[model samples]
Target: MSGFFKNAFLIAKKDLYSELRTRQVLGTMIIFSGLVILVFSFAFDPAQNTTKAVIPGVIWVIIVFSGILGLNRSFISEQRNDTMQALLISPMDPSSIYFGKLLANFTMILIVELVSVPFLFLLFDFHSIGSVGYFLLVLFLGSFGFISIGTFLAALAANSKSSEMLLPLLLFPVTSPILIGAVQATKIILSNIEKLPDAVAWMQLIGAYDVIFFVLCLILVEYVMEV
Candidate 1:
C-alpha cells in the first residue's frame, strides 16, 4: 500500500513539475475559458440577476471544454515522446500511473476553476454569490466525476487516429448524469441558500458517480493499458 501511494505521488509530482516548467495545459485552459466567458457575455447581454441563473451552465461549460483540452494531452504527451511505453514497463503498478494522471488533471482543473469562477461572476455581473464553502464543495464533486472517467478515457483514446475527437464523444455520454447533477446542484446553491436541501439528491448522485466510476476506472486501467 505504501509503495502504491509512493509511486502514484511520484508520478503526480513529475507531472506537476513539468506543468510548472512548461505551463502548456494551464495556459491553454485559461485562454479557452476566458474566450468562452467573453463570448457568452456578448451573446446574452444578461441583466443583473440573470447572471446568477446562468452561472451554473456557464461554469460547467468552461469546465468540460477546458477539461477536454487537459485530458486530450494527458496521455498524448507521453505517447508523443515515447515515454508512455517506458512508463508502462517500469516497476510501478499501472494503477499508480492512472492515479498520477488523474491527480495531475484534477489539480489543473482546480487551478482553472479557482481563477475562472471569479471571472465568470465578473463577466456575468453576478454578485451576491452565496455560500463560498458549498460552491467549492460542488466544484470538487463535479470535478471528481469529470476527471476520474476523463483520465480513463484519455488513456484509451490517446492511441487512436482520431483521438481528440474520439475523446469528447466517448466522454460526454458517460458524463451527462454528473453534469446534470452538478449544474442543478450549483443552480440551487447560487439562487437560494435556504433551499440547499432541494439539491441533496443531486449531490448524492454526484458522489455516487464519483465513487463508482473512480473504482471502475482504477480497476480497468491495467487492462486498458495492456490493449
Candidate 2:
C-alpha cells in the first residue's frame, strides 16, 4: 500500500514539476476560462436584475468547458515527452499511473476553479463565498468524477489522430450527470435556498458518481495501459 502511494506521489510530483516549468496546461486553461467569461459578459446584460438567476448556469458551463480543456491535456504532457511509455515501463503498478494522472488532473482543475471562481463572482456579481468551503467540496467531488473518467478516456484517446476533438465527444455525454449534480448543488448553496435536502441529495449523487467512476477507472486503467 505504501509502495503504491509512494509511486503515485512520485509520478504526480513529476507531472507537477513538468507543468510548473512549462505552464502549458495552466496557461491554456486560464486563457480558455478568460474567453468564456468574456463571452458571457458580452452575451448577457450584467446591469440587469436577471443576472443572478443566470449566474449559476454560466459558472457551471464555464467550469465544464475549462475542465474539458484541463482533462484533455492531462495525459498530453506525458505523451508529448514520451514519459508515458517510461512510466509504463517502470516498476510502478498501472494503477499508480492512473492515480498519479488523476491526482495531477485534480490539482489542475482545482487551481483553475480557484482562480475562476473569484473571477466569476466579480464578473457575475454572485457572492457565495460564505459557502465557499461547500462550493469547493462540491467542485472537488464533481471534478473527481470528471477526472476519473477523463484519465481513462485520455489514455484511450492519447494515440488517436484527433484526440483533442475526440475526447470531449467521448467524455461530455458520459459525464452529464456530474454537471447536473454540480450545478444543482451550486444553485442550492449559492441561492441560499434553505433546501438542504435537495442539495444533500445531489451531493450524495456526486459522491456515488465519484466512487463508481474511480473504482471503474482503477480497474480499467491496467487494460488501457496495456493497449
Candidate 3:
C-alpha cells in the first residue's frame, strides 16, 4: 500500500514539475478566471440585492469553467509526449495514474480558486456572513468531486478527435449535482449567517457526492486506461 502511494506521489510530482516549467494550465486558468470576474463585476451592480443573489452562481461558474480548461489538458500533455503509453506499460497500478493526475488537477484548481475567489468576492462587494472555514470546506468538497471524475473522463476522452468539445459535454451534466450543492452552500454562507445549518446540509451532500464518485472513478479508471 505504501509503495502504491509512493508511485502515485512520484507521478503527481512529475506533473507538478512540468506545470511549473510551462505554466500553461495554471496560467490559463488564472487569466481566464480573472477576465470572467472582471467582466461580471462590470456587468452587475455590486450594491444591488439582485447581484448578491447571483454572485454565488457566477463565482462557481467561473471556477468550474477554468477547471474545465485545466482538466481538458490533463491527459493531453501525456498523450502528446507519448508518455501515456509508457506509463500504461509501467509496472505500477494503473489506478495510480488516475490518482496522480487527480492530485495534480485538484491542486491546480484549488490554487486558482484561492487566488480568484477572494478577488471575485471583493469585486462584487460580497462577504461571507458564515464561517470562512466552512466556505473553504465547501470549495474543497466541490473541487474534489469535480476533479476526481474529471481526471478519469479526461483519460477516457483524451484520445478522441473532439476531446476539447467532448470533455465539457460529458462533464457538465455528470457533475451537476455537486455543482448545485456547492452553489447553494456558497449562497447560504455568503448571504445569511443564520442558514449555517442549511449550508452544512448542502456540504454533507457534496461530501457524499465526492466520496461515492471519487471511489467509483478510481475503480473505473484502471479499465479506462486499458482501453
Candidate 4:
C-alpha cells in the first residue's frame, strides 16, 4: 500500500513540477477561458436581462472546452521527451501511473474551474451565490467523471498522428452525461428553484457516472498503455 502511494505521489509531483516550470497547460487554459467570457459579454447584450438566462450555459461551455484543452495537453509533457515510454517500461504498476496522471489532471481542471467561476459571475453579473456549495459539489463530481475518461483517452491517443483532434472526438461523447448533469444542476441552483428532488437526482447521476467511469478507466488504462 505504501509503495503504491509512494509511486503515485512521485509521479504526480513530477507532473506538477513540469507544469510549474512551463506553465504551458494552465496558461493556455486561463487565457482561453477568459477570452470565452469576454466574447460572450460583447456578443450578448448584458443590459437586456439575457445574461442570467445565458450565464449557466456560457459557464458550462467554457468549462467543457477549457477542460478539453487541459486534457489534450495532459500527456504532452511526458511524450515530448519520451518520458512516457520509460514510465511504461518501469516496474511500477500501470494503475499507479493512471491514478497519478488522473490526480494531476483533476487538480488542473479544478483550478481552472475555480478561477473561471468568479470570472463567470463577474461577466454575467450573477449576484446571488445561491447554492454555492451545491455548485461546487456538482463541479467536483462532474470534473471527476471528466478526468477519469479523459485520462484514459489521453493516454490511448497520446501517440496517435492527430492526438489533439482525436481526444475530443472520443472523450466528448463518452463524457456528455456528466456535462448534462452538471449543466442541469447549475441551472436549478442558479434559478433558485426549490425542487430538491430534481437536484438530488442529478447529483446522484453525477455520482454514479463518476464511479462507473473511474473503474472503467482504471481497468482500460493498463490495456491502452500496453498497446
Candidate 5:
C-alpha cells in the first residue's frame, strides 16, 4: 500500500517539477483568474453589500473556471508524448496514475486558491471563519470533489478535436451539486461562526461527492485509457 502511494507521489512530483520548469498550466490559470477577479471586482463598488454577499459565488467561479482551463493538462501531456500508452504499458497501477493526476490537480488548485484567496477575502471584507481548521476541511472536501470528477472527464476528453469545449459541457452539469454545496459552505463559513450546523451539512455533501466520484474514477479510468 505504501508502494502504491509512493508511485503516485513520484508521478505527482514529476508533473510538479515539469510545471515549475515550464509554467504551463499554473501561469495561464493565475493570469486568467486574476483578470476575471479584477473584472468582477470592478463591477461592484465597495459601498454595495452585493459584492460581500456574492463573495462565495465569486470565489467558486474563479476556482471552477480556472480549474477547468487548467485540468486539460491532466492528460494532455500524457496524450501528447504518447506517454499515456507508455504509462499504461508500464507496471504502474492505473489507480496510481489517477491519484497522481488527482494530486497534481488538487495541489495546483490549492496553490491558486491560497495565492488568490487572501486578496479575495480582503477585497470583500470577509473574515468570519469559526475555525481555521474546519474552514480548511471544507476547502479540501470541495476541491476533492471538483478535481476527482474533472480529472476523470479530462482523461475522457483528451483525444477529441473539441476537447476544450467538450470538457465544460460534460463537467459542469454533473458537478453542479458539489459546486452549490461548496459555495453554500463557503458563504456560511465566511459569514457567521454560529452556523456550524449548516456548514457541516454542506461539507458532508461535498465529502460524499468526493468519495463517490473518486472511487468511480478509479474503477472507470482503465476504460478511459481504452477510449
Candidate 6:
C-alpha cells in the first residue's frame, strides 16, 4: 500500500514537473477558461432576471468544457514522447499511473477553477454562497469524479488516431450524471432557496458517483493499459 502511494506520487510529481517546464496543459486550460467566462459575461446581462437561473448551468458547462481540454492532453504527452509503454511495463502498480494522472488532471483543473471562479463571481454579480462549506464539498466531489472518469477514458483513447476528437465523444456521455449533480448542487448553494438538507441530497449523489467510479477506474485501469 505504501509502495502504491509512493509510486503514484512520483508519477504525479513527474507530470507536474513536466507541466511546469512546458506550461502546455495548464496554460491552455486557464486561457480557455478565462475566455469562456469573459464571453459568457458579455453574452449574459448581469442585471437580467434570468442571470441567477442560468449562472449554475453556465459555470458547470464552462468547467466541463475547459476540463476536456486538459483531459485530452493528459495522456497525449505520454504517447507523444513514447513513454506510455515504459510506464505500462514499469513494476509499479498500474493503478498508480491512473491515480497519478488523476491527481495531475485534478490539480490542473482545480487551479483553473480557482482562477476563473472569482472572475465568474465578479462578472455574474454573484455576492455570496449560502454555505461556503457545502459549496466547496460540491466542487471537490464533482471535480474528483469528473477527472477520475476522464483520466480513464483518456488512457483508453490515447492510442487512437483521432484521440483528440474521440475522447470527448467517449467522455461527455459518461460524465452526464456528474454534470447534472454538480449543476443542481451548485444551483442550490448559490440560490439558498432550499435548506441545507436540499444541498446535502445533491452532495450525497455526487459523492456516491465519485466513490463508485473512482474505485472502478482504479480497479480497471490495469486492464485498460494492458490492451
Residue by residue across 1-227, what tens digits does model 2's lDDT show?
99989998987888888889989887798788878887887888877767766776877776677777877887776676687888888899999888988888788878887888788778876655437677778877888898888888988788788989999999988889988998889888787657867887999999998898888888888887774
Against the hidden true structure, what lDDT does model 2 obtain?
A: 0.81
Whichever of 2 and 4 has more lDDT, that candidate is: 4
- The digit string of per-residue lDDT tens for model 4 on 13-55 reads 8887889998988888889989999999888877776567777
- Residues 67-118 of candidate 6: C-alpha lDDT, one tens digit per residue: 8998888888897658988988789899999999999999988998899888
lDDT of each: 0.90, 0.81, 0.88, 0.83, 0.84, 0.87
Candidate 3 residue lDDT tens string, 133-154: 8888888998899889888889
- 2 versus 4: better TM-score goes to: 4
Question: For each candidate, C-alpha RMSD in Å?
Answer: 1.2, 1.6, 1.1, 1.4, 1.5, 1.2
Better of 1 and 4 by TM-score: 1
How well is each residue in 1-227 modelled by candidate 1, as lDDT tens digits?
89888998988899889888999998999999999999988877668555568779999999999999999988988986589898988999889999999999999999999899899888777777577788888999999899999999999998898999999999999999999999998998888778888677788999999999999998999988873
Where is the poorest 10-residue window by lDDT in model 5?
121-130
State in Å the error of residue 56, model 2: 1.9
Best by lDDT: 1
Q: Model 1: runs farther than 4 Å from truth?
A: none
Q: What is the lDDT of residue 87 in candidate 6?
A: 87
Query: What stretches of model 4 exceed 4 Å from their correct place?
Result: none
For model 5, the stretches where C-alpha displacement exceeds 4 angstroms are: none
- Each prediction's TM-score versus the true structure: 0.96, 0.93, 0.96, 0.95, 0.94, 0.96
Clashing pairs in 3: none
Ranking 3 against 6 by lDDT, winner:
3
Report clash pairs, candidate 6.
none
Off by over 4 Å in 2: 128-130
- Colliding pairs, model 4: none
